[model samples]
Target: MSGTVIATHGLRKAYGAVRAVDGIDLDVRAGDIYGFLGANGSGKTTTVRMLLGLVLPTAGTVEVLGRPIPKAAREVLPRVGALIEGPAAYGHLSGTANLSLLDAAGPGGSRRTRKARIAEVLEQVGLGGVGKRAVRGYSLGMRQRLGLAGALLRRPDLLVLDEPTNGLDPQGIHEIRLLLLDLHRTGTTIFVSSHLLAEIEQLATRVGVLDRGRMVLQDDLATLTAPTGATVVTTTDPAQAARVLGDRVLTSDGERLVVRGSDPAEVNTALVGAGVPVTGLVLQRPTLEEVVLAAATGSGDRVAA
Candidate 1:
């Protein structure tokens, strides 16, 4: 088996004449909380479906859990659990009943072991006492938790969740965040897809960015969030400062200049020597949103949606 729990090469999928997922590659290691990020219609869903063997790829090789996908999905899937798009549960059934049904259908295990596993997962996902309530009566967050518990019924080594935090209130989101952290600590590899940059920033150790059916960027969260040198903003003549700074200037935000690749001392030396006023100089660190947008657009422009 390779070091990566999930690996893909030249992965491609098309719907009719439109290429939903272009040739792409990915490597996700065990115990990683890899975030799949993209805007609406950016092919994130398609890519995930292909990975899970739900959608056949037109081209490329895919491997999950050390087995070739689709052909090996039946054997490999037993060790994988997924909650795609949203939670799946019988609305009329109580949470505990729903879990029981899933547990019965999952891979072979002793009856007592299965029951204990179900109970443990229920508690892990924060649905302990509420398991007796009908799924329809549960709140959106509770439903999400129940679905997660069902996925855990098989004791899967890998968990794939899509927009798991959608429709969750702030407190619910916090709860899920903590739950995921705990799961990661226990050596479960989590693969999550989300459009919410803030949520991904908080939970993901690494990120894969998709745009218009192409992967624009993939990197560790720390590198993506690190300061790209100093962004010195000044209240001097912007045009002249920009010319002096040349390619080092990132942009001008109304009466202030955003310079990159230059430290404060270098920026000040150039500005003061050029006879530019030193009214104000402030350094700014780039946010995750900024980093994602820059990579997606191939420019420093603000992202739409």
Candidate 2:
């Protein structure tokens, strides 16, 4: 009933004295590729589990697709698909057979077209031909694809994926990214929990960064990575360009200069007019990784003496 497909406030999860997820709010808008970012031990998995009602929160609330979790899990979860951590299946069963069993247990899928749906999803995830292969014989990447096929079996409106590309090779990862983008184009709201900054940087419209069980930053990716009023100029004559720019120059390497100006066009004009050879000029923007690192503390996976 709200604009946000996933909304949380003060969401917390604790294991005895250890607070796995300290109070954090997550806002995932409809039609957003919301990238949930965190270092290891940052509680991203815990938060994701809570979002799906797999783990109970010690405090706060989680609403997915406008419904409260656990209380409304039966109704809500059917419309939501999730792949948490990785996936599991009967090693003895073929991928298709495994999906058949999973599909039968769920309520939303119609038994009449279950086989057809399974086949469709298998194809969607690049496992169509291998659906008949025993899961034990499938490679890790194939298993991952089969798991994704399972998640998309019912065509849920919201996809909550945790490291969806885990164990995938470069090609497999690229294919999955394309698939996710295609899904997003068709109106599925995606909440991706991943540590792969490069993938997230390419896919996410909004990003939330977590560090040591706390949310350090949450904003539109564009806002977080916006230009910092600086222009980067690459020139064969860096010294001459810097001289022409004067105090506007921030830093200079052998061939590139960081200028204290937001408009690269203006800088380019000045350089060109001053007879300085400008090879390239562009606005300097912080990358998604830079913004995330600036927000979050050091990785929690580290143990220092």
Q: For each candidate, what TM-score against the reference?
A: 0.81, 0.95
Per-residue alpha-carbon lDDT of candidate 1 for residues 198-298, written as tens digits (9 for 90 to 100)? 98889999889988778888888888877767666676588888888888877787678878854687788888998887777766766789888789778
TM-score of 2: 0.95
Top candidate, metric lDDT = 2
Lowest-sum lDDT 10-residue window in model 2: 296-305
Tell me, by TM-score, which candidate is best. 2
The models' CA-based lDDT, in order, is 0.83, 0.90
Global local distance difference test of model 2: 0.90
